[model samples]
Target: MFRLILEEEGYEVHLSKIAFEEVHEVEKLDPDLIILDIKIGRHNEGLLLLQQLRMYRPTMKIPVLICTAAISVIREQEEILQHKGIPVLYKPFDVDELLHIVQQNLLPSETKDC
Candidate 1:
């Protein structure tokens, strides 16, 4: 659903089934921005991947939008909260808001008119 809507907005989208897959995709695709869920699968989650990305030199600086329903859970994590640059989007999100955040992260600062 997100991929379709994003594609309709003229952005290329890649869907990954798990957090590890997303890390691999990021390594291969070097995407402009990443929309990550707080809880990806039963075992692996976004916080772990986010930590790995932050440690990796190549992917460290990439913008991440943390979109998830587990807002309360995330707030309890002091480590995740420490990263001020990462933006959080609670679940049941509006498409327009998602688009806006995507554009804001992916576009050049001067080029952003939205």
Candidate 2:
């Protein structure tokens, strides 16, 4: 659903499967942004992956947009508050709002991509 809406907005997008494997695969994709689902396995959740990924020097700098059906998503975002550049996106969102946030984060400032 999110992917379809986002694609219609003229932005290229990639949606990953909900699993520990997908997080590791992110490095290969080298996407500009990521939309993460906080929960993964019934036994092992993605919070641990988030921590592991954050510790990885290469991916630590990546901006993450989190969306969850549960309000507890707040706590997860709070845990990563100290992380320099992670952005949180709540569920039940407006498509425009999501795009705006994405553009705001990915858009260039005075600093060029160079």
Prediction-by-prediction clash tally: 0, 0
Model 2 misplaced stretches (Cα beyond 4 Å)? 22-24, 76-83, 109-114
Q: Which portions of model 1 show Cα errors greater than 4 Å?
A: 21-25, 77-83, 109-114
lDDT score of model 1?
A: 0.73
Candidate 2 has an lDDT of 0.63
User: Candidate 2 lDDT, tens digit per residue, 38-99?
Assistant: 76667336566677777877777676666665456557566655365666666888877887
- Give the TM-scores of the predictions, in the order they appear: 0.82, 0.75
The candidate scoring highest on lDDT is 1
Candidate 1 clashing pairs, residues 3+ apart or interchain: none
lDDT of 1 by residue, 1-114 (tens): 777778787776777768874455577767778788878888437888988887788888777788888867777864655456677777898988988878778756422111
Clashing pairs in 2: none
TM accuracy, model 2: 0.75
RMSD versus native structure for model 1: 3.8
